[model samples]
Target: MKNNFSHFLASLIAVPVGLIFWVLSSNIFDIHLFLDVLVGIGGFGASYLPTQQIFHKKHLDKYKLTNSEYKYIKEQLNQADEQIKRLRSSYMNIRTIKDAKMIYEINRIIKTIISSVEEEPRKFYRGQQFFHSNLESAVNTIEKYLYLYKMPGKSKQERMQLHETRLSLLELKRTLQSNLSHMNASSYDDLDVERELIKRNADRSKKRQALLTNKLDKEKINLKKDQAKEYVYRGDKNGE
Candidate 1:
């Protein structure tokens, strides 16, 4: 209510103040040309735009998420930011180009998602589950890879374990990449709320699939029996 009143009051005063300035400036400069009169009017109108929006925060209106949704997303973004910082601090100690490159790409994706969420929080909120799960997994896998690589390995088993971990981390990175399509912006903002409904539907679908599979298996068995009888009939005819 206060904000609305402030905006209304600003609008009411802006034009009059502009007109006063125009009139005073025009007469003092003895401006009489048509273009000059129009320019004076526009100048005053443009000057008040800043004051008109002074009460609002810039770029906040760009996001369409509800306040609660925004709060949740912002919390996740802060966690991703801290993970990125940790990766950066470990950069100098990264043993391989593969690790360094993967870490860099992880940083890039985190920043990109953060910016997208800030700009259009509602659009990306549908993928909140996908985003949070995959992003945290990626960060943890990377951190584990770094730790294992930095540890000194004297035994053959330790070396083998390090190799296996690297391979697993690579697979984790690929899995994260594959899930990126789901992390993209979507129109639905209530996806987090609808997760339970989605799970129920998925369960029903699996049950239906299982029922279909059983029906098909019975048909296959019956068809095989009929084929066997036909083969016996054909052999009897040949004997005749």
Candidate 2:
């Protein structure tokens, strides 16, 4: 309301100043000579009110979009949840000690994903970084567990289960690696979007600051003009 009132006052003030210029120019020279200039000044002052209001509204909307990054993050979280379910089911069905160890190793990897998702991304450079770090640790642990449980001679069923577990671990590792790569690429894109938004906001602030500075300069010029007119009037009275 205060802003609207100020805009109204500016327009009220500009219209008469424009009319005074029109009158002065008409008296000294031709009425049409300064008519366009007077119209332009008055029109600009009137239009500025709506323009400034629109700009302020836009800035407010931009600041409200901080959660836009959550869309991509949520998809990654869902994938992690699915992986956890698969690992948990596999762990429950293990009969042999070797099979149990293999399932335990897989569970460790899934747990890493869960922990990564639970941690705040704002605390890290990117969400992928946390996942990747934990993934390396999980893989190392899995390799160590496999080496400890190696049997030189094994029965057919045990050998088959070992092969299946190895295959599953390899597949899981591939999936984790692919997901991490894609996530890193997407993080770069996200950073670009954020950077562009910051640049736009900075540009807007600069423009608003410039407009305010120009308005202050104009007021100062008007004050000097009024002082000059007073001095001229006083000198004329003394001469008379």
Candidate 3:
């Protein structure tokens, strides 16, 4: 964010600097109008290029991913995005709420899978079934199923084909669910470990707190006893 702000600031500064250059060239140096404009552009470029390069370098390095890996992941994500669009488009062909609910569930799974892969690019490897096959298959199956279901006066054979395609869509949904589970299994394991550690730390903290409270109570009792002894001695001296 800071880098982006700096880039914006640089751009804002460049525009004015460019104008200044143009004004100085035309008025003070008596340069030609075209040359003045060129000088202004050169000034803008000079002011903008350094910050632009710096911002890009920092932004790219922030991910700690190599350029090639980043590029490949970006390309794959773009393809996944297109597949998702096709899937959503297929949803419009759904006439029944029952099948619509299935598509919705499948959509949720696909989004979660993509989001997980996006957050941890390495998980993209785990979702090869989704990005490479299952998602595309689902889209194709949904389209084919709807196309058949919409046919006029479908004969028995056509109805059976529609039924089979519906089955294929259900199977695709299950496969997508499996793909999502596979992709997130490692993350779930990590979460389990983290939760265990947090629980252990919390238990230790509770024990320490209990011990400290006990110590404080003991000190309070001891202080009360000492005060009683002092009062008794003073009373005995006064009596003497």
Full ranking by TM-score: 3, 1, 2
The candidate maximizing TM-score is: 3
lDDT of 2: 0.58
Record all residue pairs in model 3 with backbone atoms less than 3 Å apart, i.e. clashing. none
By lDDT, rank the candidates, best first: 3, 1, 2
Q: After superposition, how far is residue 25 of candidate 3 from its true place, in Å?
A: 4.2
For 1-240, candidate 1 gives per-residue lDDT tens digits of: 013544665567677776776776677766766655676677667755666665333223445444465567767767767867776776777888877787777677666666665556663555565466867776676677677678774488878877887777667666655444445524244565488789999999999999999999999999999999999999999999
lDDT of each residue in 71-164, candidate 3, tens digit only: 7877888888898888777766777888888778888888888888777777877888777778777777777787667668999998888888
Question: What TM-score do all the candidates reach, one by one?
Answer: 0.48, 0.33, 0.79
Off by over 4 Å in 2: 1-112, 115-141, 145-178
lDDT of each: 0.66, 0.58, 0.82
The parts of candidate 1 lying over 4 Å away from their true place are: 1-62, 185-240
Instruction: Show the colliding residue pairs in model 1.
Output: none
The deviation in Å at residue 172 for candidate 1 is 2.3
Expressed as tens digits, the lDDT of each residue in 101-197 for candidate 2 is 6556556645654554444433223446435454444455455436534646778887677677567666665665555444456557889999999
